[model samples]
Each structure stands twice: as C-alpha cells, then as structure tokens.
Target chain A: MNKKWMSITVSLVLVFTLLATACSNKEKNSGGSTAKEGGKGEQVTITHYTIDSPDRTFVEKLIPDFEAKHPNIKVKVTKAPYEQFDSKLQSSIAAKNAPDVTSHWGYGGFMEYYNKEMLLDLTPYLDGFSGSDYNIPEDVMNIYKVDGKTYGIPLNSYVTVMLYNKDLFDKAGLSYPPTDYEDKSWTFDKMVEYAQKMTVDSKNLEEAQYGVDFGFGERDQRPQYFGAHVYSDDTWSNGGKPSEINLTKLEVVDAYKTIYGLIYDKKISPTPAFSQTVSGQYGDPFLSGKIGMSVVGSWSLAAAADFSFNVGVAAVPYNPNGDVRSVLYVDPLFVLKDSKHPKEAMEWIKYLITTEIQEKSIELSGGNPPVNQAAAEKYYNNFEGIEPKGIQQVFDGAYKYGFESYNHLISNYSQINELFINELAGVENGDKQVENVLPDIEKKLKDLLARVNK
Target chain B: MREAALKESANEVRRMRKWKLSQIIGFVILLLVTITMLSPVWFMVTTSLKTTKEMLVFPPTLIPKVFAWGNFSELFTNTDIKFGQQYRNSLIVSIFTVIGTIISSSFVAFGFARYQARSSSFLFMLVLSTLMLPYPAIMIPQFLLFMNLGLHDSLLPLILPSFFGSAYMIFLLKQFFSTLPDELYNAGRIDGCSEFRLYWNLTLPLAGPALATVAIFSFIWSWNDLLTPVLYLDSQENFTLPVGMAAMLSSKFRLAPWNLLMAASILSVLPIMLLFAVAQKRFVEGIVLTGIK
Candidate 1:
C-alpha cells in the first residue's frame, strides 16, 4: 500500500507539472496569435514606430479613420520616447524586428540607414502614389532621396529663427530686430551690437541679464552664417562623394572666433556652468526674459505662448555675403527595408503628407510648418489667436534661404562634431583661443573623416 | 566612599551628555543625507502635482500652490496610453517571473547542494561563471533564439527565461541550501522520503526566507525591466509599465508633458513600493538569515 501510494503521488506530480507547462505555453501562443491577427483572412497589419509628440493626437485620431477606409488593413502605432528612440530602433533592426514604418529626421547621418540598406527605396511606391494629387513640394520630397531613389516622405519642416523677447528689447531701449527675410540690417554684426547694449552686469561682473542666447549651441548657427561649408563640396545633398573637413578655411575660423568671443570676451551669453545653475527652473534664458534674443526653431512658438511678456520672431542674423540663410530641419517618415507590407506603409505615408492631413497636423501641433507649400501658406494665413509678432518670418526663412545644418549631411557627423565641440568648449570657457585650437580641431576632423570614410 | 561615588556619578553625567550631543549630531547628518537621497522622489511627486506654468517657473516650488490631481485622472482616462492594460501586463509578467525563478533556481540549487558527483565542483563553477556574462553580450543570440521560437513580440520572452534559472539566484540558493543540516535529509531517506519529496516538502518549507528573497528580487527586476520588453514587445497593448512610461516621456518635436509623465511614473513605481512595504519584514529577515548562515 505504501509503495503504491508513493508511486501514485510521484506520477501525479509529474502529470501536473507537464500539464502546467503545456497550459502556460498554450496561453502564450494564443496571446501572440490574437495580437498578430487583424480581423479576417488576408488582413495586413502594419506596425509603425514613431517618436512620442504632443502632435501624436492627430496620428491617434487618424488611425481609426485609416482602418475604417481600408477594411482589410490594420495599423499599429508604437511610440518610443525621443531620447531612446534611435538606440531602440537600432536594436530592433539588429533583432530583425524593425517596425514597418518609422519616423526619422532627414539630416544627421540619415544616409547611414540608407547605406546600410535598412531603408526601403520608396521610388516605386511614389511612382504608383498619385504624386500630383498631394501638394507636397519636390524640394521637400527630394530631402529624403538617396542617389535618386526616394526613401521617405517629408512629414513636417521647421526653420530656425531669431526669437527675441519684446519686453527685454524695450527695457534695453533697442528697436525690434527686423522681421523681414531680406532685411540686410539684421546682420550678425548688428545682432552682436544689440547684444552688447542689452547685456547688464554688476560691479562684480556678475551678469544680471544676458544680452542674447542661442537656444541651440553656438556651433550650430555661427558656421552657417559665415558660410563655413564643413564639407569640401555639396556632396551631402547630391550624394556624390565623401568630403574633407573645411575647418581650416578663413571663413570657418573667423565664425568660430566671433561666436566664442560672444561667450568669453563679450560675456553676452550664459556659459555652460551658469546655465546649469538655473536648469529646470526656467524653460530657456530667452523665454525666461533673462536674455534679449534667441536664435531658436519654430517649435519655440509653443513656449512663446506661455511667456509673461510679448514675444517676436525674426529671420536669423545673416552672413556678410549678401545671403540670408537659416538652418532648416525636416522630419520624415520612412518605410523599413524588411517590412512585409511595404505598399501599406507607403499608403500610410501618402496619407500623412496629404494637404488636408498636413494642414490639420500643423494646426494640431500648434506650429509645425507643413511640408506642402500650399498647406504651409494656408496654415500661415488661417492661423488664428494672438500670433507672436512676425510669425511669417519662419515660413519666409524656410522657403527663401533655409539650408541644412552643419551636421545634417555628414555620415560621421556625430564623431566629427563631438571632436569640434570638445575643442570649441575650451575656446568658449576661455581656456584656449580659437586661433590656437583651430589647428588641433582641423587635424582631429581630418583623421575622423578619413577613418569614417575608409 | 560616598564622595568617590558622587564624583563617579558626575563623571558619568558628563559622559552621557557628550554621548547625547554626538548622537544628536549623527542623527542630524543622517536626516540631511536621507532628505538629499529622497529629494528626487519628492520632486517627482510634487512635479506631478504642478501645472505646466508652475513647472517652468524660476526657482521651483517645493509644494504646489494648486495641486493638479487632474494629471493622474488624465493618465487613467487617456485612451491612447492604456495605462491599466500596461499595469496588468507588468503584474502578470512580474508574478510569473517570481514563481519561475523560485522554482527553477531552488531545483538547481538543491542538486548542487545535495548531490556528490565526480565533476560536481566543476559544474557548479561553470554555473557561477555565467554570472560574469553581461546581458547585452548574449542579447542578440537570445533574441535570435526567441525569434526562431516565434515568441518575438510576446511576454513569453520575458517570462520564460526565468524558468531556466539565473546563475546568481542559483548561487544564492545553493549557499542557503548547503547550510541546511544534512541529517534531516538522511533521516528522511531512512524513513522512505524520496529526493523529490525531500525537496518539495521538507527542504522547500524550511527555505522560506531564501525563497522570499528570490521572489522579491525577481519581482522587482522583472517589473523595472525596460530594455527587454522594449526589444520584444512591438505593440503598445502588450507593453509593460516601464516601456509604456518611457514611450509617454519621449517626444521629438516638442518637450514631453512633464506633469503627465511624472504622474505615470508615480503610478508605475507604486506596485514595487507596495510590494516592498508588505514584504519588508520578511525581506530583511531573509537577507539577515542568508548573511549569518
């Protein structure tokens, strides 16, 4: 009896354990299958990964509409946080589980994705897509092309413009910066002169208020205004060949000295150390009204709305070469190379860039200028409410004289930029002069470019 | 003698006073350290309750003037976030991970503790060596293996790995099991207890503290895991809390809604906090017992 009982107990335990494992496995399988299934046979589910944004409401509202129209298709939108999205996307692609469609910034090593063959050449999709039906401009669409093959569709674009605090300008008794794109009076020298006048300091040289701030770092805008082409040629745009660093050029060196002087010599902008003390306490020095003006992107409009005093916009301070240029950034949506449902992804991208969707997205996002020229014009004109004075400058700056930022075209951009920034940090901090460090910066850039290109 | 006794008492009073002063100083330092350590958490709670305008105000406020309980309500009511679904997913994954880790690690630890084999030491060392291998080093191979198993986008990838036993957990359990008196096992065998029965009824019941430690650790680890879920789970519906919260915090075009993000963060951390609170006594006892033995 004892033997029989023991054996029975052991057998029962084994049976139960196996049963449990089997049940769990079955549950997992069922859960996976249910998630995979759309509704019926031949229903395609396209998963799109995108950065989380306040404008995400538009996408969320539109997905159901898209699903209703295409009964046989389902769209799953996954948003990764902006900071982690790039690394997350890379890991997902490495795992061979990349989303069908993803949002990408059109600059800053975007070609690395194309070069690695991770992006689907959407030229064929664009051909089938009634191109003329959408009001998206050729220039905007061309931004996403690599070697004559289109890979992405421009979803939204923004221009960097001068955001000046009107209250601060009044306190300094200075006239408002020119809002017109063609205003030659709004030159780099004029901006510096205004900054010098506005900067206030105590006897101890403790700045009570800074003259001006570049919400982006000085490296981003100064090089552009001075026409210091980092690349040898326009290879970044045309995709012809790799180019060498042009930091040794007189124009580049002069731009660096002028910007560095603003921080260390002129003491018009807050240093990195001073900025750290007030971190998280204010949105930005410019918005906080501690600075007279800031060269910032159109996205700053959202923050501008909340300012206690009035805010105004102007075209970025111009170069001496009789050209007014500002940095333009285009956020695009691309179809992944390994997507099983490329056609569906293309359809979604097409839907995103339509004039109606673009206009609505701009309206919903509260100032992301549309890529479609007509939609952009419509958005600018129909915009309601207490507009930030000279808001038209954003559109004018974009359409007339916007150029890609320095790092936008280079494949090894991050590495090269890091080296430049580290060298420039010394200049900014008064530890080294621009003339003294330019040689080292030039050498490091060349070595990095060579290594990366090789 | 009476005079000497009085003098000693006076000295004792002086000594006690000095000791009391030192203790007060130590207490103040500890209080400061504690506040410093906990300030970030306090900021998170307060920020969650502050309006966007208040958040961007110069010189941040410690206590919000108008508490925005609406942020929490918005988190729950937002259809797009699916916070409740993510919370459930996290709970399910964490519970399974705890059960699996306890069961698998205890089983393996028992073998290492009880058995005497020719290569037992070598095999045990081999298990310990796996602790040196970083998760990222083997992440690709493991991902590929799961992909091949058709478990790419499911919580199975997160849960199933716990069943195989972790080297660290096994090491901890082995250390614990080895401290058990061997005569109990010998006596059980003489009375006709099988090895499996010994493990199931006798040994496991006595291993309450160790098992509790393993359970709590597993639960916390699985609950806080962001990367594994982000890699495996593609859809938001299947996302765990950490992944969901991360998604909510990320925005490229504009700054994240900090108030809402903080509210979601508070919600995500509450479960682990509650678990720790409930298990605090046992958890401490487990660690103390493990250390002593």
Candidate 2:
C-alpha cells in the first residue's frame, strides 16, 4: 500500500506541474502588446534594427528629439555590427518580427527580401515626396526601383576620383592643375610622366620615395579599376541583349600595361609593400607630401582639410580610347513592409533623405558629398573651408566620368586582389612580362564568376 | 686505479647533469611557446586602450601612445548601444542556461550510465551524432518553428532551448558518470534511498567536479555566442555586447571610434576571464576526479 501510494503521489505531482506550466505560458502569451496587430494608443513603441549604435552620443541625441515631436510614439533604435546584420535581418524577416526600419547595404541583400515578397511596395508613398522635396536625383532614384516598384530611399551617394597633393607638384616644378573639369587633355600618359618626375631618390639610394600609390590589399576596389569594364554584363543577364564587358573587346589591355609600366617599367609608383603599409593613411602619406598622387574617394577631400599640404583633385585619367569610368556606390535607407506605422517610418526616411538632413548627416559624418547636385553646390557656397573647393571640382568632373553601378557582387572581391598583388610583385621583382600575367587572371576571373553565380 | 675509476664515474654524473640542464632550456622554450600563443589576447587588451588614430597605424604599437580612459566612459555615455542592459541580459541567459544544463544533462547522463537496455548504446550514439551537425543546416527550419510558435523577438527563444539539455553536454557528463562505481547506486537502493535521493544526495554531490566543468563551459559558450542573440533579440535594450560591438565596427565612412570599441571589448572580456580564473581549479579537479572514479 505504501509503494502504490508513492507512485500515485508522483503521478499527481507530474500532472500538477504540467498544469502550472500551461497556465504560466498562457499568461505570457497574452501579456505583451505585439506591434503586428496594428499597435494602437498613445506611446506606440516601434523597434528599429540598424548598424548604427546607440552607444554613439550622436544616436542618443536624436531619440529624445524624435520622441518629443511625436509624443504618442516612441522610437527605439537597436544596432548590431554589419557582419551580423544580414543574418539577423534574414532570421528576423523569416520570423515576421523584423524591425520596422533597417539600414540595408542596398543591392544583393535587398533582392533577398524582394524575392521573398516580404518587402512593401513603397511606390504609393513616393508620390507624397518629389525629387525636389527629397533632393534625390531621378538618375539615382532609378537604381532603387525593381519589378515596377520601389523599396528603398538612396541615403548617401559616393563617387571615386583621384586626389593629388598639389604641394608635391609645385616642388617638382609641374604646371598647376587644370581648372576645366571636362578637359582631361590631362591624359593617362601625362599622369605617368608627372608621377615619375615627382619621384625622388635620396643620396643613400637604399630608401626611395615614390610619386604615386595604388591600393593592393584584400579590397577588390583595386581590380574594379580593371574589372568595371570586363565582367559587368547585367543587361545580358536580364534580357537577351548583348551587353558586353567592353574591356575584353577593347584595347584596354594597353591601359593595364601602362599601369603596370608605371609601377615596374618607370618605377615611379610606390612598391607593393609601401602601399600596403600606408593603405588607409588617407591624409598621411600624400598629405605629408611623400606620395604625389593617389586614386581615392570623394571623401578624401574632407579628410585632407587640416593637412599641411595643399590639395588638388582630378577625374580618373582617361584611356587613350576615350573610355573613362569612375564608380558610384550608395548606401540606401529602407523601411520594413510589416511596420505598423508606415506613415511615421516614411516621414523619418523622407526626413533622412532631405537636403537639410543630408547636409546634417554629412556634417556629422565629416564629409559625404551630397548626391543632390543643387544642394551640394549650395553647401559649397555656404562652406568656408578650402576643402570644399576640391569637392566641388569632383562633383563637376563626375558628370563625365562616373558610372552609375558598381561591382559589389564580384565573387570574392577580396581574394582576386591577392592574385593581382602576387602577379604584380612577380613583374616588379623578376623578368616577368605583364602580357604573360593576363591569361591566367582572365581564367581566374571566369572561375570567380562561376563560383558566385553557382 | 680505484681512484681513477671513481673520478671517471663522477665525470659521467656531471655529463648527465649537463644534459638535464639542456632539457630545462627546452622546457623554457615550451613555456615561451605557450606565452606566444597567448600574445594575441594580450594585444587585443592593449589595443583597446589606444586612440582611434593610433590603432590604425602601421607596425601596430605594443602599448598605447595615449591611454584614453574616456573610452570606457564613452561606451556607457555615447549611444543606445546599452552596454549595461546587454550585460544584464547575458548574465540572466547564462545563469539560467548553466542551471538548465546541470539539471538536464545530469538526468540524461544518469540514465545512460545506470540503465541496461539493448537500444541504450545506440541511442547514446544517436545523441552524440547531433554534435557533428553544423548549426547552419538546421537554422532555417528551427527558425520557422519558433516563429510559428510565436517565440521570436524575445529572450525566451534564446533561453528556453537550453533547458532540453544539449547532446554534447550530456555526452560529457555521461563519460564522467560512467566512471562512478555501480556499487554506490546498489548500496543506496538496498538502503531504500529512492532513485531521486540517490541522484540528488549521492551521485550529484559526488559529481561536483564534473558539474563545475559543465557549468563553466555552458556559461562561456552562451556568454560569447553572437549568432543566436543576433537572430532572436530585436530590441536595442535587449542586445548582447557582441551584437553592440559589431554595429559600432561596421561603418565605412566616418571611421568607428576604436577607443570606445576597445573599452567595450575590455568590459565584455573581464567577467568571462574572471569566471575562467575562478572555475579553472574546478576544471582541473573535475578532469582528475572523474577519471579516478
């Protein structure tokens, strides 16, 4: 009787425990106000996931001001590192619990949400704000459209150009920079000639100073200089149209040989090791007047404002064939489809893209050249610094040289440069020919394309 | 002749002593190898003290040129990347996770060690096999299940899954428990100590070293995890330190202030390292104690 009673008590206890668990679960499920049911009432809290940390004093300042404007709504911003953002966004989207707004990297990542039919067709709201109101260019606006609708607003548009140290040019007794932006009568040959003239060999000869430096690290931007014209065949993929990567057809190989010549044949450019060591020395090597010229972004103008040397800017040099191109990449701001308060989200996004907001963001970030040409020109007129002069030159030059799309999806952009660095090193150190390196690289390029697409 | 032979033996002893001295030199080199392995962590700590401008310089400095104490203050003051809330959430998750691991794995391991069934060994192997399946393979399916269950965007998803007992932890505890004498359980049974009493009073108390080992491992794993918290937690108020640190490091334009990142990184590491130092004695004891039984 005692053993039987013990078993019965144990069974009773187990049943009671399970009942308690069920009751607790029911309470939890019913307790919280989830935004999915079109959250109502005053103090409607919305969650945002972004790569911006609240840890920055700047981010904290915006929250209280935003809350004060909409007393009934409180916006909470949550951030994680960029590396984790994609996976987190993916998982959150799958769960239908994603933040109301997210800062997307724009191209391939945005496609994932679009293909899943998880993104809202933001076109209906676009009419409320015009290109005039948002200060977004129609040309840039076209990049964000997909399948006859829009899902994002262009945040910051950037163009890549060459920033040169004018002090180094004056010291070498070279002519002053050309004032006319379109006149690249300053051809690739003149660039090489000036770079070589500016290079100095001290008395010891053990150490040498160079006139020009190019990035040769894991960054695929190094190869974007070559690949932009080579593998960019989007029109062919989308339609049956024969959109060709012009480099494979054109005599662009001659331009490639010339860049190789600048480093090896003329020895004017810094050695591979020198460029690697000084890679993001944005204002250092060139500003310190060691390197005469560098191919860098438009932001370099702002970075070099306080430097001791005078700065000059020019468009990327032209190939003798007249096919000159510079890359324009943008980071886009977007609202999630499931947001309960799409109107408020749209208002914030519209505010973020406005000329006033763009200038504020640029000021906060120190130098984002405005995507809105008129506003950028306005900013220039108001600005006191000598830095905006070069930035203004960059804006004028971009009209002729800039290409809208970039090769952000080139599979293993970082790894391709490893091969380029090796081959470039081989040419500089030995009796290797530049002509011999292209075939192997061409094959490697095809393989990378296959891997990424596969 | 006797004198000369004795002198020659003394010389041989001296030669052996010199050989031992060389071995000590080899051991010193081995100690240096261990220190070299630890140098990356040392560099991370020191680099966190450096100003953003100095951190990026070539031939990275071993020490800070200007140590900024404000980096720590900035970590708390600057942004919504709430280091305090994150630290609290991680502590809550890790504490509950450690407790769950000890309770569930001990029960599962006891059954494995004490039972005698034809399928027991097969089932044990099946559990061990789960450790080999990479997390990505099951990630999507598991995510959908939780979403349907309405567990997403909360700490429940992060914490509740740990209650079922991980196969890896169960296997580890089973290995330690298997080494325990069968005689102890049998004696308890004869004395009319219930199975629950045997486990609670006799088995668990004696398994302290193994329990300590499991607790420490579970705590570290949950504390350092970035992926799960990234996937489940959506609110800034709920973010873990790893997620916060990652956000601060992602920008391409205005370079992330490295000093603040470094200071936050130092804070993230301190508690875990302290736990490791405290639990290390138990870890060593567990390995030795588990083998003895």
DockQ of each: 0.36, 0.37
TM-score of each prediction: 0.87, 0.78
Clashes in candidate 2: how many?
Answer: 13
lDDT of 1 by residue, B238-263 (tens): 78888878766554445556788898
Docking class of 2: acceptable
Q: Model-by-model lDDT, in order?
A: 0.72, 0.63
Docking class of 1: acceptable
Error of 1 at B74 (Å): 1.7
Which residue pairs come into collision in candidate 1? A81-B250, A82-B250
Best by lDDT: 1
Error of 2 at A436 (Å): 7.7
Native-referenced DockQ of model 2: 0.37
Of all native A–B interface contacts, model 2 reproduces a fraction of 0.37
